[model samples]
Target: MSRAAGLSRRQFLALGWFPWLRPRHIGLAGARFRILRNGRSLRRYLRIHGNEETARQVLERHMETHEGIAFVIESRTRVVAVESLQLDPNRMFSRVGAEANLKLLNPGVAPERVRRALDLLDRGREKLVRALTPPRGGMTIALHNNSSAYSVTAEVPISDQTSLREPGNPHAFFLCTDPRDFETLKTSPYNVVLQQHGPKQDDGSLSRLAAARAFRYVNLEVAAGQTERQREMLNWLEWFLP
Candidate 1:
């Protein structure tokens, strides 16, 4: 498959056959996430989207036994209420993305309120990013759960390289932000995509921050409900990424 990992061509069908598959930080000032530290390691884990129940479950279980710090948002829904405004935690990492999301989510919000909200987010973003960012030589791994509507096909266009291993499970895949990490991950028996280059427009996603900062970032996006498969993929990533 060009310079990509050797993956057989599939119909790129909407992910259908995948095995199906944590924290309380109470705050409204800005995006809040509770910390789950299981031993100490350079490796860091994340579950930013609160509505992604599958990811939350996987991260909660993984942290109980894994050696890394896990950060999970406190909410049970996708959009979090901050300053009486709905904001996507994942999009609060950068100013541009945060501003766009803030406006889109709260269209009726006053102009002054929007400015104040962004300021609050900016302050909170700094602290969270500091704790979330992995150290040099460490890995920042994120767990995300997606439905059939969101498949690897959505990412194929922007991905630098891909390895589609599971013939029936198109939703189970790994996305990494470093080339060297991709090289190691591609050798695995699962699907993986290498996206080392940062996009021109930042989405305020963790992967974008990782690419900009030149750190190793890996995201395990599994079909919503496939905990077994997600865990397996996560374990595989930990085993080889380290």
Candidate 2:
């Protein structure tokens, strides 16, 4: 990150055109995430679900011209194979959620096996969480793609506050854990919800972990295949929030 090792303005511009840095893959347990970093920013971006092509594409495009880091799940499918069991990558953030996900469909799997898998996950999670955490002055933004069945409406029941700015576009909205971030986003021309507190039952999602640590976290969800729309919203967020 030092200036001596930094890319010049010319090189930075060319990086957008030619992509000098190929995304490097980082693994944890049985899951892998591809990391893309350009220049620097206090904030970090993420694509947690691999099947969410719209979110992944928009995030990759954003990394081309923006500063900060982005972590994307490597598999193109929603779940990854871990220890002969299907595991939801997002649920791997906590031991409880991971145990549940690993056992969800594989009920016949032994409890002893689940415990051993969780032990390995706990070790890997420590390093992964450290890399994902934001600095003191910034936050983490996660991009997701949801189906029409899931929208801001579903999140409203659990949210502390809501700003349904773009009511018609329920699939595209912002979910934030910090009240201050919620206040700022409410004024934007987009739907925003403030969770403000941890869920009664920690589902082991990244947002739950962020809230527990009091680290700022935001989720921008868009309907699938809306690549351009997600890009515009991301641009607006970066411009307005920055």
Worst 10 residues of 1 by lDDT: 12-21
lDDT of 1 by residue, 103-194 (tens): 99998889888888888887767667888889878988999999879877777778889888775777888889999988998898888888
Worst 10 residues of 2 by lDDT: 14-23
Clashes of 1: 7
Please, what are the lDDT tens digits per residue for candidate 2 over residues 1-242? 46525878887666644555543777777678888988868989889787999998899888999999889888898887777677888898899989888898578898988888888888889888987889987889999999968999998988889999999999999998899888889888999998878468777788888888888889999999989888888887888774
TM-score (all chains, Cα) for each model: 0.84, 0.87
Candidate closest to the true structure, highest lDDT: 2
Error of 1 at 136 (Å): 1.7
Best by TM-score: 2
Error of 2 at 201 (Å): 0.5
Model 1 segments beyond 4 Å from truth?
A: 1-30
Against the hidden true structure, what lDDT does model 1 obtain?
0.80
